[model samples]
Target: MATAGKAVVAQQQTNLPFAYRQYSAAELKEALRKMYLIRRFEEGAEDAYMRGLIHGTMHLSIGQEASAVGICMPLSEDDQITSTHRGHGHCIAKGADVKRMFAEFFGKTTGYCKGRGGSMHIADVAKGNLGANGIVAGGIPIAVGAALSAKKLRTGKVVVSFFGDGANNEGAFHEALNMASIWSLPVVFVCENNGYGMSTSIERSTAVRSVADRAAAYGMPGVVVDGNNFSAVAEASQAALARARRGEGPTLIESKTYRYRGHSKSDRNRYRTKEEIEDWMTNRDPIALFEAELVELGIIDQAGIEAVREAVRKEIVEGIEFAKESPMPDMADRERYVYTEAA
Candidate 1:
């Protein structure tokens, strides 16, 4: 393994006009562990909710781990990020405390918002998480504001706005993009294209076949890659982030991906075909492909992969225990964190 402070080596062989460093064995193993943790955590959340242990609507990012993990791995402690309702994966990827996250879902006082915000509204500002928004495109403007603050303060810190393809049409998306371009603010817009906006397919709703192609209209670079491909996602994200860091403005990345589940807990998903879903699951499986590449490249063996799974499982167990032991928020403080507190 490399020195503790050293950056991980990465492999990205895209035809784009940029190159991303490759990850070493240790780094790859660590990332895989984190990804597995996200997968397991969300699965557990789903199970608990189905068993009536959870309240409120649940938005699961079950099959969308690669985009969040790949893009977030490059962020620094001082950088900021804004996410959507499907944001648990994003929060986890950006290093949010898993225990606090579990507590937030359980409406416990130990959560990021002291249990006030619950699942969709969780965040830890000290860790650069600006919080997740329930409204479509709601977090877009907030992220732009964060980038504006970074520019005005000359902090040299970046902001990542994680949204879905559905958010592209919202006014905040365009307005924020225009502002970011005009000032050359530091931000990366990631569109997790999961093929549908609720029940509508991208083809029916999106005029542009590729969301990244829209970046040219804003006078920035546009790039598209297999969202399921972690290496591809990492490489593209690194390039966009580099440009942002250089004060070159925001870049739009459309991650071509799919979700194996419905939009939310309330969804029936009658609009999509089971055949289509299975195609992505079977053929376009992102994690499975990445594992294959790692093996072919001689980066890890089966034992190392198993070790990653076991480590992720252990961390999740601890997180669950922490959440279980946490105290719920006082019912009297229900209205807290909704607005400014009284003096």
Candidate 2:
């Protein structure tokens, strides 16, 4: 690794376009572990996809790990989170088992959805992950419904709805936000604004300058944070979640982030330039940024960082092997879940 002072000076001199909070050493290290786990898990999934071991289309949250980890930091195991198509990181950060996640990707019986839902539909209700939605804004309403339930039941549980910038244009987003605001539902609408909603850039498709601006219309607090910065994201989420828990109502948090991979495996680079992607990856990699900060802050040396990386790598490899060795679903039960089981 480069010298600690060099990293600190370079980062300090560089002007960050948005506001972010500083992190404690312990918090930084924990965040790094989670972020690294997400990265390695995503990489494993990509490798499996490329090798033809996984079927069906998948969306990898390769560059958006920080957003997932940071947002979930303030959440409880009992607090629900609804996820979009690119939601593996959300599940991982929320304490979903990586072995089961790999099994889901590989379509094994031990998968979260029993191999039925695959990558885009994995869910663990007990872990507070409602599920990942294939539709752009499908999870929004579900999260709202969960928040409503929590309020009615007086469970003191908050719901975090994770969606992409593209989902903002959907009618579901509007309806859910409006309803949540009026009811003062315990929900946080987190928009991972990765610049583009698939092929259409935010500039071309959206009327508002920022997604956070849309919160004013719904009569709630809207915050725009540096999604690549874990500290910034965590602080923003903490505030938003606090408001939700206090019954202050929903919050719209727009996390400005970037997706390193194409929208999916099928997407080409026709919509955006290689230079733009390269710039984001080189300058704003969440993992790299956090690593440097940890070094600069004297939280962890490069060796300690490497140890975390190696551990995460080992876990991912073990998960993949476990998924491969897991059994396939019994063919006789194919007709079972299609109908509701009798009590």
TM-score of each: 0.93, 0.93
Per-residue alpha-carbon lDDT of model 1 for 196-219, expressed as tens digits? 888888899888888888888888
User: Candidate 2 regions off by >4 Å?
Assistant: 1-24
> Model 1 off-target regions past 4 Å?
1-20, 338-343
Q: Which candidate has the top score in lDDT?
A: 2
All candidates: CA RMSD in angstroms? 2.9, 5.4
- Model 2 clashing-pair count: 0
